[model samples]
Target: MHSTNAPASRILVTGVGANPGFGLTRSLTRLGHTVIAADARPHAPGFLLPTVIPQVIPLAADPQYSDVLEKVCRDLAVDAVVAGIEHDLVPLVDMRPRLKATGVRVWLPDAESVHACIDKAAFHAVLTANGIPCPRTWLPEQIDEIPDGVELVVKPARGHGAQGVHFVNRREHARVLCELVPAALVQERLYGHEFTADCLVDRDGVASVILRRRDLVKAGLAAVSTTFDDPVVRDLVVRTLNAVRARGVCCVQGFVSDDGAVAITELNMRIAGGFPLTEAAGADLVGQMVNGLFGLPVDHGRLTYETGKVLTNYVETLAVGDAEAPQRNGHSRPVASPAVQVRPDARRNASPFLYGAETAAVGRVLRSGQYGHTDVTEEFEQRVARFLGVPDAVAVASGTAALHTALLAAGIGPGDEVIVPSLTFCATIQAILATGATPRFVDIDPATLCVTDTLIMDAVTDSTAAVVPVLFGGRAVDLSAVRDELQERGIAVVEDAAHAFGSRTPDGRRVGATGALTCFSFGPIKNLTCGQGGMVIPRSPQEADRVRRMRLLGVVQSQDERANTTTYRVDGFGLRYQLSGINAAIGLAQLDHFATTANERRRLWRAYRDALTGLDGITLVDVGEDATPHLCQVLVPDRDKVFAALRGQGIGVGVHYPPNHLQPAFATWHRGTLPATEQVGEQILSLPFHQHLTDNDIEHVVSVLAAALDASGGTS
Candidate 1:
């Protein structure tokens, strides 16, 4: 191992997908230092290197770049950072102060110097001002002024490597290319031998330069290179470095003309791609860089290298496996998460109404390079808690996860019975089953299609561990009279408020604020769409902690906490039910415009109510005024025939649910017949109800419903 004056550090190296970064990572690890290999692409070869920690980060241009980098540095306890590519140089320089404040060391030139080196036009100006010979350059607007018969290179002013670099012998071709390339510039093509100087400038302003000839070049990289001694190239490179006020590890490339004149071409503010030759030739470049990075004096003498040593590189696959092998692995729910499910178009079908800000929010979260439960998810949780006036809200992957997590946190397990109505979605039953609790199906009050306190108490047995009151169609269920008795009997109240997000309880408090273990679905068709997510409002801080731990696979420590240490503890059973930042971002956006959504949904529900008034043989299921209606349901005589006729007439009608207790999956839990729930199940028909529906749409739907009822003989 290459010994150093100081102990090895845990260094983060960006741009590890490229050769320079890939080589730098291996070299640092060889020197007994830990390397965090970071790249924008997940399949970057450096990620597969043994003993190197792989990290996929947002692209440097992403707005969240600095924040994500800072979090990575902090979480991994990184001591220093080194840029192996030019793309990372500007961002790293901009983040230098924040990184330093967080105790992560970064050695970079000032912003002005970095900008000057990266911008081709600026590089040319600096060189010319310093009396150094270089190519004549012109911006795109100056294309017409180019002299005839001169070969030209058209490239981006702020380009790197050979990307967007095109060569042409004619001015017309150059002009056409300048229009095609963004931030394009033209430079006079030079003819001669190309050379790159691997350079390190000490804090004392002294410099050591290693010169290497591009013996065999390919794709802007020196595929084969031999180190050489040349005073003309060395002096010019040093002059160019000093001209731009460059500091730390950098490189200068130029050409040695046939007449022995040296033209400084470009300067890069990072390690050279072929610097492996410098190390092979006995230079302590990286070691001295480490010294300069830690505020220690650089030993310039050790930066010296022997001449005529050669290094060559060839293409070879580092790994071959499934491209999706690097997926974010976690325990996903047995049911598909909402984010992946297809959603209906708002204009054409009953569907979620996007407030136009959701895409931008999701994009921002995606660029943050974190998908799992994070600060974004936490922000969503806090916002929801504030909206509901609750102590805390736990966000999970889906609505089923919310119910499952809440039930588990409430101590509902095997041998316990949960009293729930049979008139709700199958997801409710599945969540109860997932917790290993038996569901005691109960009858609902036909008027509200929600279970009554009397029905709940009548079904409650000595074995009843909890009572899950499903808020059907955004209508709240009031069980206050029996709540004391249920508590006395040690039965917890876990509310399945999937459709009652903005509804109020009997006491006029928000449904989730009534001190019950309430769950809300931010699914695609809910009052608020999180693109498919759920929230659990815990009644106590202890319950919140239980759900939090259970969502991330029983890990006591959070994702951030686990990053700082080498190991973590699993406190109990759990699943991969954590809400991803992507979904949380969507939820945050929806919450911001929830008031407008509530108003529109209420207006549409009223429109349907007015149109259905005095309609024969149809009874409107009441969702109280305090509720933000999620569905417009009516019990019609001959419901099956009317439902089919409405579908045939394109009215977008559906059955709320079949009695869950009678379904094949829940047959074992069937406790005889729930007469009211059974009647509602057969008669209940849900019309198209969403924020997108207008009075005109409702009128059209009501007219179609009237026609369908007439066609079905108008009676049961």
Candidate 2:
């Protein structure tokens, strides 16, 4: 039944592959609520439901089940959880404290109460203790004590769904069946009319039950059922619920003899499979349960239903397709290490990859107690210089600091202007501003989001003291055509190679080795992180010395040299931008495995390229073959709506930049309209690209992207 007055909620329904969970998910969605349908099977039928976020989880018995469920709830901000099967009841009861901290509400009785209901032997004991009529049961060891002519039902004690249940007339046959079944228990088989009660117990120990007779049964589920009221059965169900202290939604099953004798057999702490019939008979079962789930009062008056309504169920095909797992690429294996590391964060725009050695290296540095510019820092600088085939590399606090000190070293000041692309990160513009030089924001090529030679040459002026060509998306900018011209005009070229750490120029030289003053960021989420550091590739020995001194507060002497004397010399203008030895140690550990990181990134990008082929209304932003791609972006129509749709599905889509020229911080320096930059700003969307992604993850992302585009009317 649809309840218009009930508040819509974000509820997670588990065991969605089963009929109870599947029907519940559909009904909740029909009532205008958001549902996160979860199941242990990847191809569960409920996953195909409209407007539902589908998630695959571990089985209830797995140790990682609780942790994964908690992460899903916290990540999706789910309000409440409803289990549609009995397998999850015990685990959900145990995870109460943990799930409570994550702000997910689960309505269940205490652990003992749940065990008593799920365990048949325990259920018999509890009902018998309360003086309620129930079937006589015995453990596997006591099966021989049964009467000779009594028909027996042998089944697993802690099982559900009628699995592994058998009927036999003799004690020898029952004993043999008990040996075959796990945790076996035997009970006297009863011959009577069967019925199931759809029940809801409020917090005040009061229960309202609507009874339905199993007119036609198959595989332990009612194929056809009719709702009816009987004082004797309702009284027995209420007693059973109170004896177990049941709360929230639950169901009770038992036998009704022709002589009016009632005997309860099963009590499951979840919604019954045939609950829709109760709703069809005019009962607000799910709605009132939702009220009690969120701590509102359950209205028992709403639980009243007509007695003559009938419901017939048939097995219909919900979905038909493949069930096998998708194949994986060979290169998609995890990083091999001496110790384990956490998986990469695949939801962010970008994140760092760490090998196991980084922790040990950082520990060694901590033990040394020399966190200043020490031998470790110098070793990191030399290692980076050798990798880029450069004469020297200077380490600093961050990529922004590298740009600030490098521009200052290049003689750019308040009266000067630095030409930079408006399509780059804000930090690039702020770095130039930090050197007292105003930014001459220029347009990009729109294909690579990089400044071309023609664009840079067109923006040059007499006040152009330096040109900062941003290496956007790890694609190097080729300024070869205007390099000599800019030099003749005394304009220095400083490469903002923050995203181009391992990328190469067109001439087969590494980006940092192109003879331009290059800066590489090793920030937390960069391709290579020093935790929080950056590097500068200087053009000459003199430039290297100047940047080195500038990073150490303009001190002319090194740390070792200063220690030999009373004081250090403050020779020139500088800031405290020196990279700590601890950070350098992390960088050193990363350098040893740089080759694997680069290969993994390139492979993941190609996976995306192959998956997105032939899709309409999507133009992938190009990064040349030689470039070690830092980001995977696509230009699509209606990007904002597409981004929101994808994010609603938890795809982690983001916008790399929003045009620095249009930003208020750089509004004063806005020269004119940048048509290409402005248009590209609205169309570019960054997909999640990182080293930890496998081929299967890429497939899921692309599939979701297609759906999002179709929903936004972008794929026309």
Q: Which candidate is the best by lDDT?
A: 2
Put down candidate 2 lDDT per residue, 322-362, tens digits, no spaces.
Answer: 44333332212222222322234345566666654677799
* Candidate 1: segments with Cα more than 4 A from true spot: 1-349
lDDT of 1 by residue, 1-716 (tens): 23456456678998988988998887776655667788887667776564465667888898877887887787556889999888788889888889989999988889999989989998899888989999999998898899999999999999888999999999999989988999999999998889999999987778899999998889999989999998878888889989999889998999998999889899998888898899889898888888888889888788788999998987756555332332244211011123322122112336776654577799999899998888999999999999988878999988899999999999999999999999889999999999899999999889999988998999988899999999999999988888899899999999999999998876789999998999988888898889899999998999999999999899999888999999999989999999999999999877876776787678778888998987787899999999999998999888999988877766788888999988999999987888898888888999888754544567778888888888887734
* Per-model TM-score versus the true fold: 0.53, 0.55
After superposition, the stretches of candidate 2 with alpha carbons farther than 4 Å from their true spots are 1-346
lDDT of each: 0.85, 0.86
